[model samples]
Structures are given as structure tokens and as C-alpha cells.
Target: MNAGAVGSDDPGPLVLGPMLRYIGETDATVWVETSRPGVVTVHVDGREWAAPTFAVKGHHYALVVVDALEPGGAWDYAVHIDGALVWPEPDSAFPPPRIATMDRERPTRLLFGSCRTTVPHDREGHRTNGVDALRTLALALARGEEEWPDLVAFLGDQVYADDTSQAMREFIAARRDIDKPPGEEIKDYEEYAHLYQLAWGDEANRWLLSTVPSCMIFDDHDIRDDWNTSWTWHEEINRTSWWHERLMGGLSSYWVYQHIGNLSPSQLADDEIYARVLEAASGASGADRVEGSELDLTEAVFDLARRTDRHPEVYRWSYRRDLGDSRLVVVDSRAARVLEPQHRSMLDPDEMRWLDEQLSGDVEHLLIGTSLPFLLPPGLHDLEAIDEALAMGKHGRIAAQGAEKARQSIDLEHWAAFNDGFVEVFEMVMQVARGERGRAPSSVVFLSGDVHNSYVAEVVDAKARHGASSRIVQAVCSPIRNPMPRMVRVMMSSFARGLVRPMRFVAEHSKHVPEPAYPWAVTDGPWFDNCLAELTVQGRDLSIVWRGGEIRDGDDAHPVLTTVASVRLPGPSGQPPGALGWASGSSAGSVS
Candidate 1:
């Protein structure tokens, strides 16, 4: 890893990315990693944009901001490192990477899913996890067999920092004692970088990322399972000798690799760390320098990470994007938690306020992208609310201790587990639906992934008491690769169906539990397939499709994408005419 090799004579190799991110009608950002510090350039439309590389630890990286493009234009692009072509490697089979800008006249299609694990794309890996749905989509896009999405939002768990694969474990064993503290789990920044490289380095997926814009938010597995589940859990983890390093490493690397790319150019410009790095790299700062070359941001990143961890309020990971008449608000559910025992909330006060403002409904469709489902199956939601009550000392100390153990053991820490916060957010949704926030949208949809299964739930207002103008629904897709075990799937199925009546009765009668403001029921599926979902919004029409990869004729190298479920959500007036055959009625019913 040469740190400061100068010029094109010793140009470094492109390692990862040319990942197209944060695209608008006329501008976009391209991120990359390189073997050494060198300028990264993007060539498109007979023009080139270049940015100097910045160093972090021993790693060199750059984000080239390409601007002044035609609105709604599609331009093929190439990457150059120090004036040498490195992208579209010789003899490449796929089409050259292209930048497709947003077009308001066309429908907005978003491809989204979460909880993917990195493994070999072979028979054994497919058997152990499942075929990679994202990879299948990539293959389709590369072959021009499917339409390209305007954006892809990875809801969460893009990497499992705690659950290392055999390859990652081998990488760790070669560097450190895997049997020691932190074990095979990632311990520091360098390891996280390697983990990301492994996750995104696959050729098919890499090409997809290079051509499509993406937005992402981290879930529990991005750091550890059940991360920040509770204050007790937090205190328990902080006591470990390796927790500090793990925390800082996960957060800082996330900032560099994932978070910054999610921001628009204006947002990036306002970021303090981004500003500092650009200033130092451009030699605009008067600070003492070793030749005043590319700035090293390792220490600065760690400082920001430390501050973010200690005071989560100081930074907001949530962001909003308005695409034509639709608004997409991606929320940071995991990190923005208010973990105080007496007043537990999935989001702190500030984050909640921010979300309230972002939930306005002037658009035809309002999409809320949360890593955790805002609406769980009714029975499971009740069980989690009860568990939260017990854990909050509603039944005294002994019961609280048992509830805490149960919560962590079963991963019962979704929005329902934070009962008060759940209700507050629900009220906000209700307000939006009722046209209180603004002109109510045709639909207020919550897009989420997690819980290892996919489903669609719709709010049921039996008497039309709220007079809601928008169709409120929850659409969830999970595990772009990883599949749930048989037993866990059975348990979840029971929760989704068998326990509904009993749990609802218990919840309604319990003194500690508060009645929900509105009843909702799962209207479609509890599908356990490893799948990705697509949401298309064309004017007042909205539809969602879940797709999974199916290996055909034993061709492990290429899996065909098969539709798992398709639903056409009704608008304010009613179901759209000529709806798809599989589109289910949004009638009020008992919970799943």
C-alpha cells in the first residue's frame, strides 16, 4: 500500500467501485477505492471530472462529483486513475457503465431489499443461504432484459459485522488470533474495509452499483445483532475490552463507505468532515504539511465516530429525497434510538421531530424507508409491546430481568418494542393520511426490510373514522441472500397467524399495555424467500413486486428471477381499474 506515490507513472489499481451514487437531474457522485493515492477521474459525455484521492489509514479513496449533465440523459461512462483507463476491464462481457439521470416525466422505480451475506456464488453457498436476488437483478440489468431502476435503497444489514463468513474468518485468522477477544467478528476499521470489499467486489454486483444510484442505511447486523436494543444491552456491550474499537471502526468505516454516498451534493458540502477532507486534500488549508498532499482522514473520522456514538443527537443519519411528485424519506432507526430505560424510544426527540417534518404528503406517493417495519404482524406486535412493558418494570424487577433476556434472545426490539415511540409515529402517519400535514398523498407507504421475511400490511379503519385520504400500507422485503432456518420460519408463521387472536385479547386487557390507535392486518404473504422488492410509482398508480432468484437447469452461475408476490395498492378513491390478478382487496380483517 504505497501512501504518496506521485503521478501517472505509478498509477495505482482501481480496487472497488465507480459506484454511482447520489444522482440528480444534472449531477452525480462516483466513489472509488484505489491501491494508492492518485486522482480519480470520470469520463462521460465527452467530458471528464477529476478529484484528488484522500487517505484513511493506509487506504486511498476518492469521490468524483460529475456535474453539468443534460436532464433525463443517459451517458455511458469510464473511469481513469491518474489518466489511465482502469474500468471496463479488457474483455468485459457486460455493457459499459452508464449514468441515467432522473426524469420527472417517467415513472420512478426503486429496487430495494436488505440482509445480504457475502459467499461464493456456487451450489454450496446457494444451498446454505440462497441464490442472491440482487445478483440475479444485476445479471438481468446487464443483459438488458429488465428495466433499470432510478435508485436502489438498501434498507439495512448490508454486511454482518458479527457473523463472519468462512472467507472473512480466514482473512481474520491470517491477521490476528481469531480465538481471542472479538473472535471472528470485525474489530477495527481495516477489517471493515476488507469486509465491504468482499461484500461489493463481486463483478456482477459491482457492475450494477456502477450503473445505478444507491442509498443505504445500516441495521443491527451492520455492527452486531441486537445492537442498541436497550440501555442494559448497551452497558453490557460497553463493558467488553474490544467494544470501543469495534464501535469506532464500524461507525467510521460506515461514514466513509456508505453514509457519505447516500447524501446529495449539497448535503455533502454541508458535512463538516467532508468539508475538512476536501479542504486539506486541495491544499487550501494553511496547516503544516508533509508536502501538503492528499489529506489523511483516519483520525478525523474516528473523532466524528466517537462523538456520534456518545451523543447520537449531534448527527442525523436520516435524509429525504423528492423524486418528481413522490417523496422518499429514509429513516435511521437503529442509531437514533433513545435508550433511556424510563422513556425508551426507537427515535430520540430530535429525530422524531425531523421525521414529523419529512412526512408531509403533497406528493402523490410518500415512501418511508425504515430498516425495521413500522407495522409488524398484529400478534407479534402485541407480544413485543407486552415484552417492552415488562422490561420497563411494569411487573417489577424479577419480571423485568426475565423480559430483558427474552427481548435479546428473540430479537424483539423493533418499533413495537418501543411502544410509546411506535404510537407517536403512528399518530404522525395518521395525521399525514388524514390530510393534516398537507394535501394528503394518494398513498402513505412504509417500505422496510428486516425480520427475515417479506409481507404487506394495510391499515384498517373499519368505520372510516379518520376520514383518511391516503391509502396507508407497509411493504417489507428482506434477505437479498440469507434465508431463515426452517424452525425460525415456522415460529414466525405461527406469530403471523396462530397467535393473533390470543395476543390481541391479552394486549387489550393488560393494564400495562396501551391500545393501538389503529388496527392493521397483513394483506399479502409472509413469504420467506430471499428476495428483492420493486416499488413503481407512476402518477397516482402504485404497485409493488417481490422477486427472488431461482436456479434453472442447475446453472449456479446464473439464477433466473421469479416473482414471489405482486400487489397493486389502492389509491384514495379505490382500487385502480384493471388491477393485476394477484392484487388483493384492502378490506378490514382480523390480524393475518
Candidate 2:
């Protein structure tokens, strides 16, 4: 972990953050992990807001909600633990963290990517995984080389609980026997806390996170590979003795560390668990006695996690954020799934209904953020649909058994795999795009990450009749750190480039597989890279750029970002459908 001490005499109390989380017109939430239970305070513009730390298993954390600030305001903030300043460490190279409120009059710039693994930011780590693109972006932002994004959305796989690095393995070994079940993988909440520290503890990225508000959703790696992929998979995993503890740990930690901050102030106020935590901590004495007397939330958190696991409808991880004229709806595609074999769905009935309500238009743009891509490459989509058909006993019971093994083995559980859900959601999106729900936005964009590749696809009217007024597109950026293996890349390339026609033929011929409501084609990528994507929405115009880190002159410490792809989608001023302006030299291929 990075040092929190400010000087020789004072050992600071901060453990992880002063991370700027949710930001609204007038209120902002700053989250932190302190060494001891204390009242964490944020001082800004002659104003201070403090929140007492709540203990979970021995770790103390607080989310200081700073309110009554001006809309579109930018204020430099300082962190204090029990009246002693702890953040903006002495002689820090980066600028002091600032809370920047949403500016409705300005364009919204959102930076997003996924699947970053924690590793040393040295030459060896770069050689294995390429330079950390997020860190490179952090350096650029610190130097003011790039404008700060309105928000950074970590779509999924923020931490790999199953794929432990050497440091995580060593930490696990020190705590328990590695030869036991759940060996090397994170087993409980404490291990999850350490794993998150490793992921976010890097000085540069931590500073970046401290300033740029972020939102997140979980993918398979957050818990385990192919987690909740299907009912059969769930049943098989439930048979294991360690799965219960692992599930509780993953869910509880996710709730405390990630989900709570995604809420707006009003939503937080309405949350029962958040209310309980604050009520318990409210009675604690000031920082003097807080060390041992802070409210302990271990049981409460675990119980909530258990309840969420049993009945996901009781608690919602999905959330919606309105930014000026645009709306971002982040879906909990992983945990809020309906996993029954007879009727599997990517989202449960409640989540689907909520999503339906959130998809309405009237703004300049509508952004749907799902960890898994709602729209995959046409070939892969058809293949997954076919897999789902076979898995559902459409081709006979024997074939269904074999298809289940293949589904889990190859991770074929995207939207297309849940055909019923895919059709329903696609219809909803079509309604918004067609202006049936409201005034058709200039664009209805799906922002996603997964598949270890980056690409852009434009959804077109399958039948050249009754076309929609809005541009329907899928913009996917993935693997901010992780890179695909060469062989897998080759396979993905074939599926993307060569198999489209053949897959379409098979899907059309299959009796069980229903045809997609709309056809889409990749317009930009299949770029396999450890990269980040930036989407800017100004009025009706929209543009997206994908970039990756490049090491020059063996300078691994300060890698430079190089653009991988750029595309501009024309606004709604009579531009022809599918008209795209690809930036020159923006080629499609592996960046590494």
C-alpha cells in the first residue's frame, strides 16, 4: 500500500482513499479507509462535512457526504482524520484532489474500460501485460495533458478474486493454508479488502480515483469465472463447501466498497443498510474513543449480503445517473440474473422492469452501461444463441447436457445466450430509438466491456423499411490491463472477420433459434489491447476514442498513451444512416 504518513513525526491515519465517489448538483460523497475508527472530515471552501467511521470486521471506513455546494462547482478539498490532515501527503507530485460538480450546460465526457488486474507498475509487469492504460491516463490527467472526464466508469472486473497475483497469493498464504479449498482465491471479506487495496493502492491511480468520480459494475472475475452463468452452473457451485462464504464475502464487500457510493444522496438516504450504518455510528463518541467503540457492521453487512444472494429483488445494484441532457443506466448484469434452466434471463423480472422504465428518451443521448455487451459481434451472437438453444434441450436432452459443459467451458453467457431477455431488451431499446417512448435521442449508445477486445458496432434496420431516427450503436472498450492470449485472439479474429455469413446462415436455418430483431455490423474494431475509451457527448454530436499505453525509450515508469481507434457518428441533421468518419491511421488490430 502507498504510504499515508505526511512527515517524520506524524504517521497518518488514512489507509486507502479520499476517493471522490458520487457527485451531484450540490452534494458529493468522498469515501475513505482509515487506519482506526475516527470521524473523517472533508474541508472545502471554508465548509466542512464529517462522517463517523463504521467498522466492518476491524476495518474502519467512512463516506463523508459534502453538501450545499454550487452546481458546476470545482473546489479543492482536504481530508482530515480526527482533526488531523491526512490527505494530499507532503511533497506530493500530483495536484490536490478536487471535487468537481456536474455542469449540465457542458458536454459529458465519460472514460471507461474493464478487466484491470493489480500488478507492479514496473518493466516486468509491463512486459507481461503491457503498460497499465489507466495509470498512463492518470499521469496524463495529472499533468493536465488531457481534460478530466465527467465520470470514469469501471464496467466490470475491478478486482479478480479468482485470478490472484503473486502478491495476493502471498497475502493469502500468510493468512491460511493454500492447500485448502478456495486456495489462492479470495475466501472472505477480509481477503477481498486486501485485494481491493492492491488494485487501487498504486499512487498514481489512487490520486486519479481521488479526483475523478467513478461508477462500477461487477463481471465474472469479481467473484469467479462464469459466476451465475446458469442454473446448472449455480447448482454445481453450490455443492462446494466454500462457495457460500465466498459469495457472502464478495457480495458484502461489493455493497460496502462499490455499490453504496453509486447511489445519489437521496438514494443513499433511502437505503436501509446505509441508514442502519449511520444510525449505529451516530451514537459513537468523538474520535477520542472511536478507536474501540465505533459501530461494528460485520453481522449487518453479512446478513444483507445473504439476503441479497437469496432474493436479489430486495436490493438493487442497478442504478441510473442523469447528467445534464444525457442519462446513464448502469445494469447489474451479473448478480441480478434469473438463472433457471427453463427460463434463463440476463436480468430478473424486477430488474427488467426497472430497465424498461429507465430506457425512455427525451435527452440528447441515452447510454446503457452493462458489464457484458448487450450486442456482440454478429457471428459470436449467433453462436451464443445457438448454444443457448442446445443447452435448453431444443436439440434433445443428450445434446443439452453436452451444450451445458461447452457453455461453462467457453464462457458463452452474454446477452445472446439469454435469447428471451435479449429480444425483450432489444425491443425496449428499439422503442426508445424509434421515439415511441419519447423524443428520439440523437443516439442510443450501449457502453460495455468484456470479451478482452474493443470494438464499435452500429445497429441497422434489418429490413430496409421504417428506419429509426436515432443512431443505434454499441461501443465496447475492454481489458484496461489484461491482454488476450495470441491463440484466443486468432480465434476471436476469425469469429469477427470470417464467420459472419456462415453463422447467420446457421441461425436462420435453426428451428429453435429466433432471428434477431435488428442486424448490426462492426464499424471500427476488433482491436485487442489493454486500452481505455473516452466518449464525449455534446448536443447531438457523439464521438468515441480508444487509446492504449505505449512505452518509449524503455521508460516504463511514464508510459505514453497512443490512440488505437477513433470514430465520429454524425448527428441527426439528415446525415445518412451508417455514415461514419473514421479517423485516419486508426487501424484495427492488436496494439501489443
Candidate 3:
């Protein structure tokens, strides 16, 4: 990325990201949404590229593809929507600004994080949560202050219609005439359109979206918590007639607001309706439909994708990308599940089979991006597993009725909640780990966020796997902005390690199924903050660093390395704490 982005006084409102998607078999598709019909030009390395605009339902979209780019090179692109520069000028209104995009020769840097709340940008700036960390990085890129990255892989919860901010509320109040009450959320097509405007209105974040090549999927908050998890979860939500409208609103909006841009050409084909928009993008003049093609075929695709788990193979929220030798597979943890019965799987079998095909033996690093961590704190993992079994009619009363009510209250449906899905993914990874069919990539790394905390772990030989010596690392980065409550941190620590041991005991004695010997250990930390993880492979060694933004003692600021970790294939065995160095979320002096 050149970082020579020209700033404009008139920064436009066509928000760009949670900038995500991959350069794969399909052309490199850049996704963005505009308020009304207009022309948005995406410039790669200062050259104009293919801009396809379309409308769906009612929203506007732009997908610009920089055709035939090199696999290992870094390409910086600037965006102009209808002649107005989209990213903000240096000294962004948000303060201390952002230091984004670092230039590199190869596919070394991966900037990523997830679960950001779309709270109204506190204009008063108080309770505003001020500047965005990722956006700060973006400012750096726009000003050529930092190097450009190879890619940005956003995990999930890119937008939160379910959890709106004061700003969003205000937006909804004016545009909507709902009689449900003050906090009554958006329910149908029209209301969802308003929600999307609230989520993507910030000029700075929107500009960053325009420039950075991003890849994204959804989490619960993208719609509502625990969406499509089980029969019980589904029943509770469906009990109210408005529930279906609420869900349809969420998913339908998701298709409009986020999912449309993430599609590769092949994925678009699977998206029966979106395929038409892609086809129309090539027409002599109607390609503008990409921006306003909303409320049409795109809306229909969302409805079908939402209402039925029956056509699991038709539209997938999952995608794959190849950057040099590394491969990233982003999964749709929410939509691709077999959540009817508690015993059912999280990933439908067909999706699982497709993933099996995608994970191959060629890459140096294989990153599996899922909003929910594959390996939760063994304690939480087991707890959800236990609840899943109990809910499946294992115990009499609890299994029969109490479990259903309990399921609704607590979040019992992550990978662990749906143990079947959990087991399936675990086994599939192990198969890759054991070098069974796929290319047996060196490190089968699981990149996740949504635990409200962050840590790194490597899966080793469990009693269940017996003698298995594969390196499956789980790297988690969360809340590019939202941090968890401090009180819970203490409890998360006390019950973390010990929780897994008791889980092993319960599984072995009560369930009578042999449990995997607990072999994984946390090497980095449960650090919590608004952070963006930068992943790089300098040479033979791979380094994943978590960066945090900060203000200095003098109140000026800069972005620096908070946590640094490196993984060499067959990494060092007898290592100590500082061996894999560490520093505060901020290193030393502020850049200002």
C-alpha cells in the first residue's frame, strides 16, 4: 500500500469496511456501501481499477476488483466515491489520529481484530470511546506515516444492529415510526436499512474500509446473540411472531450491510441471487446496480439464507484466500450450523466437507478465522459441552425442561455448546495436524475473537489423541475497542485452568466417554484491550504481534507493539517468558 492517499476536505459517507475479503480464485473484490447512487473509484497503487456498483433491496454497494495482482506483493489503494476522498485527512477529528498500513515486500503483515460495537460515535467525545484503534492505524496509512499491510482479516461482529448506540438510536428515531417503545429495535427491511446507516456512518472508519483489503464474517451480535444455535434457541426466538421479523431483519441486513462484499466469484455463484448482481456488473451500463441493487435479488438471497438451514450448500458464509504461501479460511460460525437439536453439529456436514477441501498441504501457515474460538478456556469449553449434553435429555428434569430455559439465559452454543460441531472441527484439524489428507500446513492456527479477552494456546497430545504431537495454535484478538468489565478478569483467572481439570473428571466419570487428555497450554496471556493483531512472516519464522493505541504522559500519542509472539515451524522447546519478549500495549514515546 503506497499510503500516499490524497485527503479531501469533503470526506464522503460511503463507509468501507470492517474491510475484509480475500484474493482467491475470484478477482480481489473490494466491498463498500454508499448512502445513495454514486460512482466510487478504487485506486490500486495509484491506478484506477474495476468499479462495479449495484443496489440491493434498497442499500447501495460497490465492488472494485484490482485484476491479476501478484500473490506475494503489497498493494495500497485509495478510494474516491463520486469525486470525494473517502478517508479523513491527517489529524483525524477523533484525536491523536491513526498510524495505519506498513509497507512490506512479501505477505508478512496481517492486521486483524473483531467484535467492535457500532455505538453512536460520541460526538461530544465523552462516553464516545473517542478514536478507533484500527482507524488510528488508518490515519497513519493515509498520511504515509506507516507501512501498508498485506491483508486485514476481520473475525466477526462487524455490525451490531441488535446492540445499537445512542447515535444509532437517534438515527432510528427520525427515520422510523415504530410504536414498540424507545428501545424497540429495528424489525424488518426498512428499519434494517436505517440500522446499517448507523453502523457505517463514521467517515474515518469508512475511509479505512475503502482502502484496506479486508475479509469478514459474522458473529452473534451482527444479528442477535446465540442466533441459529439449537431447536431450543430457535423455539424461544420463534415463540414471538416478531422474533422471525427481528431475525430476518438482522440476517437480511447482514447480507446487505456486510456479506455481499465478502463473496468470491465462486461463493457468489452459490449465493443464487447475488450471482445475478455479479453478472449484471459486467453489463454495458447497468453495472451501477451493484450500488443500488439492494432490496432486490440481494434481499431475496438473505431471506432464503436466513429462513432455511435446509439448503446448507446453496449459500455459504465461509471463504478462503491465498497470500503467497499462507492460506486463510474464514468460517461463518453463525450460519453454517446444524442447530436444530442440541446433539446437532455447529457446522453442517456439507460445509465441513467443503472446508476439508479448502485446507490443503501447501501453505506455510493456515489460519482458520472463526468468531468463536475453537478452543475456549478448557473450563468454558467443558461447561458449554456439559450444558449441551444436559440439554440433550441426559439428566431427567434439567434435560427435559430446565435445560431449555437455562439455554435461553446463558450462551451455551459456541463450538463447545454444540459439541458435535466442536468435535467435528477438532477432529478435522487433528486430521490435518496428523498429516492425513490436506497439505498438513506447518501451523494449523485458529484465529478467533469473542471471548471478550485474548490469549494464545497450542494444542498438543491429549489423552484422547494419545501420542499426537501436532502444533495447533489458537490465537485470539478481541474488541478492537470494547474491553470487558474488570471484575470478571479476576474470576476468569481463578476458574480458568482449574475449570478444565474438573471438566475432564466429569466427562470421564459421568459421561463415560473417554476424554482427550488436556494437553494445550496458554503461552502468551489473557490480555484485554482494544487491540489489532499484526501477523508477519519475516523469513522462516512467523510472528503475530498485538498492537494497542495509546495517549502519552503529555497526552500526545502513537501506536506501538503491545504483545509480540513468534512461531517458527517446530518452534523452540525450552523457552522462558521473556524469550518471546513482551512490552506494554504502548512501547515508549508517543509519535506526536
Candidate 4:
């Protein structure tokens, strides 16, 4: 009910997006959630591709594959529903959708952040929180002041299905009894749909999604906090009465909304479930059908979601992309986890094998995007590892129970919790860095979120004490709108620093686990401002700059971006491995 072009004589069917997605050399995917079932046409470069909307449980959506565009070409585009131009409303402030095709020569620039909570963009909302960084960045991009990133990667927590805001809770209460089962959190597909609308329904963010191509992967909050953390946690959650419907709804809606666009045209073609839907839709002339002849794919799609969630190995939520010489491997750390007690692994064996195969170093930059940081701060990493060990009966029964409670309470399930997986990935990274794999990459960068704070860390190759061939770095940006509490920030900072000696001491003395081959430290920050990160790959050097919102003139309604920190990581120059030359400033600094 955004009323986008509502007062106009020609009202549009589009409700959600002309969202640019999966941009390849000569083709791109455009998605839209419409008000009704209709034939949606994507008009670009004087050519148009049309697709009819499909309904899944009464929600109408369409994916238009626009093909045969010149590489690196930028063209303004429009959306038409049944031949009436509906997008770029007459009084629209942002520019029309400008679809840009990717070329290998162009530098790959990506803007990424996670853990955003949707709220009104008003004086009250901005007083303590300032403005949402994504909204501010969208405005700047609209004004042509900030360069458009090649794509935006929303790492996780796109919506807090478990942690609902007051507004969302109010809506839920109105719909059903909040005193009933699954009181405050989302329970089904309809609730999930409304949650997405809350998250992306804002005018600025909506328009930004219209123009910028994006990819997303989910963290725990997308389902629930500490989702699939351990066998005990999984068993407990499964015992809950409403969890089945919640999981089904979460995964089903995610596929209908977010996951569909992540697949390439070929991938879609090869997908059996999607292919069946496509075949069925086409059989009834669904593609060329008139406005009312929509295909109801509710059962098939939802059934696929149920099957996928039940057997994660049967389908992959993880994906890989090649941008110029840089290969980005987006890991699905949540659902693909192997949580069996005796054989705990961060990734199931099949998922781990797939990731290892993707880790070859022929690309100039190997970027691994995991929802959880692959390399946590050393102290934090060791503590989580020790907790995992203790929880596995390294300690007595009572102490083990305490360890389990502590692990679930503090969210101790990260890469460090699974020592086998951590060691395998670390040694794999070392092999890639030292050219033992394929051609060595200039840098192996891990892009992560979900820690609720932004920071940078570097891995020191122990083999080469003085210097190493490849730079291994971890960059984290979180909470595009949500900020950590003051107490939580102070606690996390102190705990990160305070546990170093004790964690190392225990790791060295304990025979239950092997010590890490390399150690890392927090190089830049633990800043708690709501921020988004820009990671640019230029030539052989990769750099990250965190940007946050600020109110310089106390204009609560309009916040401007200030650099939180900037680190220009040059390709390994045979210098010391952990040199990590970087620059920084406070959140209000004007530094770019």
C-alpha cells in the first residue's frame, strides 16, 4: 500500500520490484511482485521481454529474463503491465531503472551489509538511530553523487523472522491472538510476506532495489537465532509445536522471493523442480496467457521448499560467481551445517567438498562470503572452540550441560566451534595462498556479517614468518540499520581483548584440540554504528571502506554518510604476512 503512482490515471500492477538480479554478460533477470496476476514486460534498450506472473498461495510474482544486451552497456529501462507503463511514476524522484550489463574489463564494486531492522524513517526513528545507511546510500546514488556499485550483496538478517519489531507484532496481534502459539514471531508464509514488505517497502530502498542488482544469503535470524547451532539446539527447536510450519513458511517464502533470482538462467533450466513448474506453466500457454490465466504453483513450490529444508544436500543454497578475475563463493553456513554430536562440521561433507572445489586460486581475488566470519578474532575463536570441546564431554556431565547452555546463550556456534571444518578450511586457504592449489590468488578475502559490529582481521601465514605471497583478510560489516546496545558493545570489546592470554594458554595445554596454524587479530574496529561496506576490487589490490549515517546539522530526517574506517590492502608485496597497512577514523570523520 505504498501508493506508488496511486493517484495517477494509469495505476501500475507492480508492488515490489523492478529489481535487477543475476546480471550476466548479455542477459539479466528482472523481478517484480505485482498487485495481481498479469503479463509483466521489461522494456530496455528499445526492446522488451515479457513474462506472465505466477501465483504461489495468492501472491503474484514474475521473473523477466532480459537478454541480448551489449556487455558493459547502460540503458534506462521501464516496467509495463499488460502494456501500460507502471514504473517510474510521474512524480518519481529517482532515475528510471538503468540496467547495466557486466563486462570483464570493468572493476567489480560491491556494497554489502547485514542485520537490518525495518522501521519508519522519521524524526523519532532518526533521533537515536540517525538514518538507515542503505536509505542514505540510495539517496546519494540517486543524486548521482555516489557511484553505483556493480551489485549489492545483502549477507544476512534481511528480516528478523524471530525478532519482530513492535509494528510487526502489532500487525500479528491484529491478525491473530498474540497469546496463542508462536506468540510474537512470524509463523507462516503470509506473515513472512508481510515481514518482507516491511523490510523492503520503503520508497527509497524500493527504488534502490529497482536499479541495483543484488544477491543475498540468510543467517540465523532469517529463521531464528542460533538456528542449527548444534544437535541439542536443533532437537530442542524441533520439539516446539509451531517450528514445522515456521520452517516451511520461512524456506518456502525465501525461495519464492529471494532464492529464485539467485539462480542463473541455465541453473533454472537445469533445476528439476523449477523446470517442472516452467513446463507446467508453459503447457497451459501460461507465459503468453492473458491477465487472469495465472498458474497456481503453490503446492509444488512449497513442497520443494519442504524437501530442500529436510534434505539440504539435495539442493544447494550456496552459489558462486566470477567477476572478471575475481571469483565470489557465497557460502550457506546456516542450513548446510553438520550438527551431529560426534562428527560436528560447519558444512556438511558434500557442502565442504563443493566449497573446496571452488577454492582454486586462478582468480586474482578469491572472495568467500559466509554469513558467519570464517576467521573470528583469535580469542573469540579459541573460546568458541574450547566451548565446543567442553560441550562434547571433555568436561564432566554437569559441566558439559553448562557448556551447552553457555554455547547456545552466547551464540558460540561459528566456524571455530567446528575444529575439523575450521582446520580444513584454514589449511585450504594456506594452500591457495602458497600456490599449492591452482594459480595463486593475489588475496583471499572473507566477507562476513552477523557479529552486529564491523571490523577487519588478517591471517598470518605461520610458514612464512616474515612474508607471504597472498594476503588473507576478513572484513565484516553488519546492521545496515540495527545498532548494538551500548552494554553489548562494551562487553564484546572487552571480552575480545581480555580472553587472549587465557584462550591461548588453554589451547596450548589442552590435548582435545590442535592449535591454529595461524593467528589473527582485530586490525581496524568493533564499531557499533549502523553501517554498510563497500568492497572494491581494482587491479591486484582489494580495499574495504565502512560507511555509516550521521546527522551533522542535527537534521534527524536526513542523515549523511561518514567513513567509519578505510583499509586499502595492496596485493602481497612479499612483505610480512600480517602487516595489514590500513587507515581509520571515528564514525563522524569526513574521510572517504
lDDT of 4 by residue, 411-466 (tens): 99999998888888888888888888877888888999999888899876533762
Residues 428-471 of candidate 1 have per-residue lDDT tens digits of 98888888888988888899998889888887762275678787
Flag regions of model 3 displaced more than 4 Å: 1-21, 24-27, 38-52, 69-105, 120-131, 140-146, 177-182, 265-271, 284-299, 306-310, 461-470, 512-514, 553-592
Clashing pairs in 2: none
lDDT tens digits, residue span 429-448, model 3 = 77765567555555677899
lDDT (Cα atoms) of all candidates against the true structure: 0.85, 0.86, 0.62, 0.82
**Sequence-dependent TM-score of model 1:** 0.95
Per candidate, the number of residue pairs that clash is 0, 0, 48, 0
**Clashing pairs in model 1, backbone N/Cα/C closer than 3 A:** none
lDDT of 2 by residue, 102-166 (tens): 98997999998999998888999987787788999999999999988999999999999999988
Top candidate on TM-score is 2
Per-residue error (Å), model 1, residue 351: 1.1
lDDT of 4 at 94: 77
